[model samples]
Target: MKSVNFKKKLTRLFFVLLGVTLVYQTGRTFFLKQEWQARNCAYEMVKLLFPDAWDRACDQYGLFCFNGSEKPMQKCTGVVESGSIILIHGLDEPGLIFEPLALALHRKGYLVLFFFYPDDQRIDASSRLLFNNLSSLSLAGPVVLVGHSMGGLVARHMLVDPVIDYAGARARTKVPEISDLIMVGTPNHGAFLSRFRLFMEIREQCLLASDHRWHRLSGFIDGTGAAGIDLLPQSEFMRHLNSLPYPGDVHCHMIAGHIFPFPVNMPEQFQMTGNQTLEGLLLSEKNYFLSVLGKAGLLIGDGLVSINSSVPFNVPVTLVKGNHKTMLANCFSGSSRIPPAIPVILDILEL
Candidate 1:
């Protein structure tokens, strides 16, 4: 009788503690700026109640075998003319983001292939997966790799470090006969936006949830992962990657976005006053600071990457008038105005 009473007391204590934890977590999530945090927190509570919820969601999205047999690539059905063009998307991309560009390339008689990966994984891991997928495919003629944002880093990794040695010294060679590598708004140095990766993950989850096929996994609890860490400018991964020489055979080009065209100009009134008073000196210093800040803003190309970051190692860069997101074809609105990068991409591929 005493043992039974003890067990009952313990059970009650557990319930009370659990309730407190839930309440605290809920409160914290609500206060967070990013809505995804709250959404994910609620999903966690539901998942705890229904252990099979995660599996059900994964199944609904056909992500049950996400990184397994479910081929990491989707080839567009069409006649091949200008060879195979592999379009690699960036961080947090749910694969559908490439639809507009893929369709455009497909319409141009190019065998367009979309390479999809679990973007939250390590950059090297994604690159290796790409290498494996490419190995399986018997790509005929020249293969042009077009990577956007972080995807460019993945492509570069595969090109620079393609050899994968298996057991007993069996090594796989790099993907051969590459024509050109066109990076669209790729952060060659690093992306400042990576610091706010939680927001990015949330944004991506929202994009995934909007699609019928991916709505189930809207509550998926994956963070930015190592890829986000590696995207930092001073990360060891970035340092090592930058140190490696780009593949000599592959021709590299960069298409950078310049959202702010006009240079910032300080007002004439802010100019230094020759008065020798301390107040005058302070005012002159403030004006100098403002001038420097204006120059820095201009360097922040596309709002996420700096102009210097976009054009690393002296790769020829073409500046287009649009922000990072707008440079790509408008997938949602079906805007009549062509995206600035599309024409430039087409022109480069033609050559």
Candidate 2:
């Protein structure tokens, strides 16, 4: 009788423990789902307000934004001022991203040329088109090329095009000649954030975890294959891209974003040490190593882009406070809560 009673007790205990575990697991899953939904909702709101900005991001080519249409191009109706400045935004970002800076530059008596390119096509095509348009207009004066992220790369393509003969091109322009190149949060070196397994998983989770009905949006993923390749650093692409020599006649400067303080709950891939919180990790050399290491070793960066990754070689560097996503999110606004670092880049350039 005693033996039978013991067996019955053990069976009851097993079922009780199993029930508790299931409840905990279910609750955890539910919490994660809720968090992801909230974030997606926020990003979606940003997308709505800045569709053109996001849509104009560089696709496969290192070109300015343009529709791949064969129609005769419309001449820029907007006339250039003496000290005109051209603005280029990064991959998946829009020209509006530079609105604050654009207004500032305008106040300084500088006209701004904002270019938009499709994220679905090669960047070179857009570059050729931008060149053709400029050639037709013969824009000449002192030009300042200001770009954020991939825009900087596109600007490099323009300033260094051998066919244009850097010096001769400047002499024949109808618009201002590009004299200075300012890149804000530009990933001249390439992104390390793309190599981490955890980073990819988290991105998948953020986009795929939510059933918030945004997956059906027209450019939600924007050329599934194109999106992934653009995010990753291609050695072949990089060699070709970096091989384009920097034009000696122009001055190049880059501003990098660095968020000294980070959230505690940030992903493990961003953590500097296995034992430290994200905030703690940002305060040490370990974080820098992660940023400067091999392709997969970038553990610390501007939320989305690594620090070393943003350095355009030999350009003067400026550091700001914010993460990659923060540049576009406008954290001060309730509807847009991104950081204010890259935006600050615009301010510096305008000054």
Which candidate achieves the best TM-score against the true structure?
Answer: 1
Using all chains and alpha carbons, the TM-scores for the candidates as numbered come to 0.67, 0.56
Give lDDT per model, in order. Answer: 0.65, 0.52
Q: Report the lDDT tens digits of candidate 2 across residue range 121-144.
A: 234434554565566553546767
| Model 2 ranges off by over 4 Å | 1-75, 138-140, 161-168, 171-175, 192-231, 261-299, 332-351
Per-residue error for 245 in candidate 2, Å, reads 2.6
Residues forming the 10-long window of minimal summed lDDT in candidate 2: 59-68
User: On residues 129-221, what C-alpha lDDT tens digit does candidate 1 reach at each position?
Assistant: 777666655555678888999989988887786364211111233333677899988998887577556667777887776664454444343
Backbone clashes in each candidate structure, one number apiece? 0, 27
